[model samples]
Target: MAERKSALKRAPARPELNEKLEKAKKQVITEEQLQEQRASFVYGNAPKGSRITKESAIKATKHIRVVTPAAA
Candidate 1:
């Protein structure tokens, strides 16, 4: 007796895969352009506390600095 091939077995079509690959290739953009676009969104919208006064900056740095002990 000869073995028979299954009729349900099939291979994927090439055109669908090619179309997906072409779409993926066109979606890429550079990081520099992305950053430039993001910068435009916040061009004039500064946060309330974003303005750093000299006194406040000095105080913040003083509080955040770590002191080291002398080695014997």
Candidate 2:
């Protein structure tokens, strides 16, 4: 009996994209940035100089509202 081959062949991997993925995987985050993220999560606001009042937040975001999609 003859063996059947796959109809679809795998595309060759792109070194450029692979390089980008490698760089992303090896990314390093500064301690300051990490601390800022932690502070924001803990305080529910930006740290120190970046602080914005509730009014500012609402105004800046233009009063965002939760949107529920219509059922299909």
Candidate 3:
């Protein structure tokens, strides 16, 4: 009987790997840029038992800034 084939897998192509690395590098975000992005979540109609807190609201929006409406 002939020798059995190896089950090892080949690594990703060099060019493709380099392109992926480059894309990842470009995806890096700076603190200043992060501070510039902001999202606002206001109290809105929801199920009667639903609730939202300041910290939770901020975290739900990810690292971006969270703004809230000024008291009327």
Candidate 4:
């Protein structure tokens, strides 16, 4: 029986991509920017007293059969 060996090849390193990655690593987020982002997520532009309640959810889904995995 004869034996053979296989070799793997790799791509050359990119200095431009390394420089971009280093720039991205040095990027920082300020506290004000973080607070603004969190506020935008937590508080929407909806009018007051327009939130959905449990009664509203029940009423909306009264005629629908929302089947669960457990029921199936």
In candidate 3, which residue ranges exceed 4 Å CA deviation?
1-7, 32-72
Per-residue lDDT of 1-72 in model 3, one digit per residue for the tens?
Answer: 999877797865799889999998889787555533422333232345677654454465465455898999
The backbone clash count of each candidate, in order, is 0, 0, 0, 0
- lDDT digits (tens) for residues 1-72 of candidate 1: 999998897776799899999998999777555554445444434356677554444444434445698998
Which stretch of 10 consecutive residues in model 3 shows the poorest summed lDDT?
38-47
Return the TM-score for candidate 3, rounded to 2 decimals: 0.26
> What local lDDT score does residue 32 receive in model 1, on the 0 to 100 scale?
59
RMSD of 3: 12.8
Evaluated at residue 66, the lDDT of candidate 4 is 52
Task: Candidate 1: list runs displaced more than 4 Å.
Answer: 1-25, 44-72
lDDT of 1 at 30: 79
lDDT, each prediction: 0.61, 0.66, 0.59, 0.61
RMSD in angstroms, all models? 16.7, 14.6, 12.8, 16.1
TM-score sort, best first: 4, 2, 3, 1
lDDT preference between candidates 1 and 3, better one? 1
Task: Identify the candidate with maximal lDDT.
Answer: 2
Tens-digit lDDT track of model 4 for 1-72: 777655565657999999999998998988566555544543454355877554444444444455667764
